[model samples]
Target: MRSRLFDAAGVACVLALLYLERHLAPVPILVIGTAMALCLLLRRAYPVPVAAAVYGLAVVQVAVRPAVRMVDVCVLIAMYSVVKYHRRLLWGIVAGGGAAAGVLIAALVEWRSDTGSFWTVFSVVGAVTATVWASAYSVRTRRLYIASLEEERDQLARLMAADERAAIARELHDVIAHSLSVMIVQADGAAYVVQTSPAEARQALDTIAATGRAALTDMRRVLAVLRGPSAVVEERRRPRLADLAESGLALRIEGSAGELGAAEELTVFRIVQESMTNTLRHAGAGASLLVRLERSDGTLAITATDDGPGSVAGAEGHGLIGMRERVAMHGGTFAAGPVDGGGWQVRATIPVSG
Candidate 1:
């Protein structure tokens, strides 16, 4: 619709000018000016083709008529359209060159008649054509640059969303996997001793209930993160290493983690929890495991050794991989393999700041 309005205005202006100067080759003026005006309708849709057609008629007009024509202004409009709409550099250079050449031809013809100064005509026409082309090229460059920035912003948003999902998965795995392992162990022991030992069975049942409540609380905290900041939810504190004692796992630690950052403490807690969970699920009955954490030289080192008949081959489960990723996020090193003598050992080292 905008193109139609521009075309109508261009046609009206061209016809009006030809009417005032109808005395100088009225037939050629009417024909060429009308063609140029009509071509403006397709300028945006077919910029290069319209530019080529307009310049072709301009060359013919310059030859037949010696003086500058008002219809000649359409050549600058066509040059602008070519560079503004098309992304190709070759088309813009071709259009600008064609306009310049036409301007020089008209100026030369006027100079020969001694009626107009050639330099004056060439300078004014060349400046206007060059200005139009340069302005269009500038607009095109800025538009493309903004588009690329928007694309980059969208890609970064997608990457952030993916990382958020992976974090959620890791949290769920740590919470559910650890709690279920404890409950399963307790339930199995209860089943084995329920007939002969009622007091021991009752203790196992109580432990199961406590483990379920802790798991439920941890699950709620994890879910709250997905509900957005507007949701009224209390943030859970980082898990302490001492909390694992209630889980009945034979674990040991040798250093004070009081100075560790909240993130580092949580990472440490999840690593040990996942290791204990793996030990419970993979190791057979009567298997024993020990976990040790030591701080020295501005670093915290973690080790978990289990005297279970577990092999190192293909031991990289989702839980262990998650533990490795957690440690790596803090610029830490992690390794898991079979011990030289027996069982499996998982070790990690994380840097700390005082």
Candidate 2:
């Protein structure tokens, strides 16, 4: 709507200019000028057609009219509109044709008029034509640059969103896999000794319930983060090295509990959880797992060793792959292999820098 209003205003200005110069030009010149000026009304919407009409009128006026009128300026505006909105190749052709026609008209008018010099008339026409075309071409280049920037921004946004989704998937996999492994083991143990050891079976049931509740809480936290700004997301407590001991795992920390970014902390916690879960799943009941965290020289080192009959070669699951990806994301190194004489071990070293 705004553009249309601007085009209307341009057309009105041209018409007024033509009316003021009506007496100076002949009837044929006046008619051609009026047609060319009116064509500006459709310049933006139909730039090529308006340009063609203006150029045709210019040719007719040059052939018949004795002198140029103020309305002749509308040709430059039409040329500008064509260059601004049309394709580059088309604009190039129009600009070339307009320049050539302008030179021819200047030569013919100079010959017809006995007063003005040829160079003066030609210089004015060439200058106006070049100025309008150059201005429009610059504007076109700027618009294209801006559009390319917008496209790049959108692409970057999509990539970031995909990265975020992958992170969420890794978190969910760790939470669900660990909790389910514990619950399943506890359930099986309870079923086997229900009659012989009623108290032990009841304790196993309680453990399963607690694991389920913890898994549910973690899942809700993850979902809240994914649901966007409208949802009131709460900061949930993330697991630390101490959490391993609290969970009754045979875990020990051997370094200062250095401060870590939220992302690094979450990655460490999930790696530990998944490792312990895998140990429980493969090592069966009465198995012991050991976790160690060490901070030194701006690097965090994590090692998990389990006294379970596990093979690193056989540990080809999504959980292990997720751990490797997390380590790699922070430019860290990861290794998982069987110990010299016994169980399996997983180790990762992550750099901590801004």
Candidate 3:
């Protein structure tokens, strides 16, 4: 809209200048001048074509009258618009050079009749044309630079949003998958022994209720973080090596515990939790799982091995992928596969600064 208004004002000024000099120029020159002035309306939309037409009309006007007229100044406006709107600098330079050459040649043609030196007229016209072209090129370069910066900012925002979503997914998966696996196992056991053994059945039911409550609390904490950084979040204890006892996995420690950050602790907890859950789902009854943690030489090595004849080929799911992603976040190495003899093992090594 602003370009349209600006072009309209330019055409109005050129028409007024042509009217003031109407008596000096013949009817043919006046008609050509009016046509050239009106062409500025489409200059931005069709810069190259409009520029070519305007320069072509200027040559016709010169052939009609050898001396420069007031209406001839409109060609400079066309020059500025062409360079500002066009992306190719080579084209702008070529068009600007052509127009400048035309001005110099026209001034030379009238040198004998008019009382001015051809060099003086050429110098002034060339300087004005160079200044207008330089200004237009500068504006175009700055506009492109700003556009590139905006594109880079948008790409960074998308990457950050994707990372946030992945983090949320990992947290939810670890919480829900582990809790549900435990509840399902306990519920099945309670159903099997409800009539024969009342005490064991009641104990299983109690464990399910406790596990459900803990899962709800963990989910609430995750949701609170999602709500916003400013939202009130209750502090809860992070998981540790000792927590594996609740999952019925035997634990062994080879070295003293090293100081770890909160994120590292949660990563360790989730890794073991997922491994134990996989074993429980895939291994049949009477299977045994042993988890070992060895910390030494600025590194912590974790290995979970289960002695079960069941093949883990059918147990590959998002739980295993989530564990791998969690370990990667800490710059750790993880692997899970069937053992050489007849078992499955999940192992990971995490770096520490102890």
The numbered model that scores best in lDDT is: 1
Model 1 weakest lDDT span, ten residues long: 230-239
Q: Is candidate 1 or candidate 2 better by lDDT?
A: 1
For model 1, how does the per-residue alpha-carbon lDDT over 163-214 read when each residue is reduced to its tens digit? Answer: 9889989989999989999999989989999999999999989989988988
lDDT of 1: 0.82
Question: Candidate 3 regions off by >4 Å?
Answer: 1-78, 87-98, 105-115, 131-135, 220-228, 231-245, 248-256, 286-288, 340-342
Error of 1 at 60 (Å): 10
- The 10 consecutive residues of candidate 3 with the worst lDDT sum are 248-257
Candidate 3, residues 257-320, lDDT tens digits: the string is 5788888778878887887777667776556777778888878888888887636755557888
Candidate 1 regions off by >4 Å?
1-74, 101-115, 223-227, 231-237, 310-313
What residue pairs clash in candidate 1, if any at all?
A: none
Could you tell me every candidate's TM-score relative to the true structure? 0.74, 0.88, 0.70
Query: Which scores better on TM-score, 1 or 3?
Result: 1
Candidate 2 colliding pairs, count: 0
| 10 residues in a row with least lDDT, candidate 2 | 244-253
Q: How many backbone clashes does candidate 3 have?
A: 0
lDDT of 1 at 268: 88
